[model samples]
Target chain A: MVPKLWNETIEEHRRAVREAVLETTAALVAEQGLRGVTMSRIAEESGIGRATLYKYFPDVETIMVAWHERQIAGHLAELSELRDRPGTPGERLEAVLERYALIQQQRHGHAGELSALMHSGDHVTHAEQHLRHFVRELLTEGVQTGEVRDDVSPEELAGYCLHALAGAASLPSRAAVRRLVAVTLAGLRPQG
Target chain B: MVPKLWNETIEEHRRAVREAVLETTAALVAEQGLRGVTMSRIAEESGIGRATLYKYFPDVETIMVAWHERQIAGHLAELSELRDRPGTPGERLEAVLERYALIQQQRHGHAGELSALMHSGDHVTHAEQHLRHFVRELLTEGVQTGEVRDDVSPEELAGYCLHALAGAASLPSRAAVRRLVAVTLAGLRPQG
Candidate 1:
């Protein structure tokens, strides 16, 4: 068996290589569209051998999927942190929705093709499920505090927030996105 | 120039052929999905000769675009008629939103591929503009009657309603679609 120190160093090197690969591919995709990217180009740009790149990711499509997974994970973590932070349930919900809208706004024109490719598969479904649950929990908490409407179930309300916020993709400005989030939140307010 | 009788006959025939082509192509797309459709199949199914079909549309894509245009026109007309019917402005708005939500609900799994193909063109842009204006007008009238919240602009509220109702596309039942419309309308109500 390898020594403990040797094993730790190897694992760290592997993680570093994976991170470099994901970041390099994302930058290449940004510079050139998805169609313009290739595995060999990624290998060259990342200063890794083509054979080694293949070992890490078999193709450009796989690399894109990995990058998208990383992006989704990061966004979820950010929302989760915001939800856990000190704030009223209403405030937390607003912060999470704003972040989500901004994320959608930033994605406009940045990855239309990439999104079409990445939106399929299990990862996306799982991520959507996780997101829905996260938002539902926040709304549920708000309802308990009398900050959210009781007429709608938290599950349905979660769907409303998500679908409304998705409109941010076509919005021309961050201010428009914020307005959208505000309107959505108003929909969640307790009925008078 | 042709005589009046001859001209009228030719115009009627042209319209009938155009309608048949659009309907046939839509049916083919529904039955076999977008990829499986073809110009020859459309011509054969519509009972129009290949030469005659070519004169009407250049290819399958053009036929699909024409079909989509007709569909949008029909939907816009339906919404307009509902809006113009005898009712209070608030009731008219609810009728329009409900109809739109039902349309989205019925569209689930119906022509997703066709929608992606048809969404990018000038026709879609104009249709969206018309829709936004229609909804905005309804909200403006509602605000005049003190039925809608005045804090948000009618234009922004129009965006919210549309984006929120679009959630109907994924809802599992007509009941759920109605519920979505209710939640969206809840956002439009005057704040107490």
Candidate 2:
């Protein structure tokens, strides 16, 4: 027999618990450095019981992976908006960098723990893999359109883009971040 | 009253302690994530007294800063080497990217942690600030020579570069990272 809607409601409640765990982690990470964050700490800060926290995340890494996914969704949305603007490929890419840099500057301090955690060292989550695949698709599209060079693959270029922006996000201000983004785009200019 | 070698000895001793702390924290973070790192844990792992560790780092954040500086130093060295090679601006930039991307692939696990820590919540350290300055200088030089674009500022571009590469570093392999770099560089090409 199919599970009842009440069962479905229970699943919905389960998801909310997971999301609550992630949301609470994000806020805590944004506030305290990663060291300050703990499941117990999250439990305390989130006003959820430790048992509830445990029910949602097996460990800190699982909770963080969820949190990082949330940030990635936001960033991908920004990337789509940036890339979709009407302009030359160079201008669009530059705009993406500028916009990304600005956003990063705003989110830098607030994001350190999750950014550090979503990275390697923990098990690769589906969201991390999915985001990579999505970004790779974006790069491949850039190449197929002749908007990008064919020599280097989309994956490598995506690395360069992420590495540069990670550095940018930690800078002191939007102007500084924008300058970095602009120059990096310039550096990427295709040969004569 | 001559403390001739005293300062040098003290500096050397301090350097050794600092490196020990960084190495230990790097190991701990690799095994346990940045949150796994702590002053007491580092002191225990490194076999240094808690007081000694405190004398050097005062907290987890300062030690992280030192470690990040060490990681960036590697990238900067690779870039400097690539810049010295005989090539047109386009060639050099591509070469530098190739070299740097390789370094990133090799150092991903460790350096990726440094990045994650750099992003983890609260108070930007001097090392983070310095990395931005370094990227700015590199990009400014690229722009001035017309090897890179001038329309976008160096800082904005650097932000994108950091974000792309750091994200790529978490991917499974070198081939994947290289493709992303190529596509991004390709997109930087100027329209005829």
Top candidate by lDDT: 1
Task: Specify the highest-DockQ model's number.
Answer: 1
Provide the lowest-lDDT 10-residue window in model 1 chain B: B116-125
Q: What lDDT tens digits, residue by residue, belong to model 1 across residues B82-116?
A: 99999889999999999999987776553745754
Q: What tens-digit string does per-residue lDDT give for candidate 2 at B1-192?
A: 759699889889888888888888888877887666778899999999998778777788778777877877766776777777887766776676666666666666645656654655354666556656755566676776776566666665555554555555555777776665665464444423
Per-residue lDDT for A1-192 in model 2, tens only?
Answer: 766988899889888777777888888877776767888998987788999788768888777777777777877787778778797665676677677667656765647545654554555666556655655566576666666555665665555565566666557766677656654554354434
TM-score, predicted candidate 2 vs. hidden true structure: 0.65
List candidate 2 segments past 4 Å from native.
A1-61, A70-113, A138-148, A158-192, B2-61, B70-102, B119-123, B162-192
lDDT of 2: 0.67
- DockQ of candidate 2 (2 decimals): 0.38
TM-score of each model, in listed order? 0.84, 0.65
* Candidate 1, position B21, lDDT: 94
lDDT for each residue of candidate 1 in A1-192, tens digit (9 for 90 to 100): 899999999899988888999888888877776767888888889999999888888788777877887787889999999999998999999999999999988876536456645652223546667889999999999999999999878998999999888778778888888888887888898777
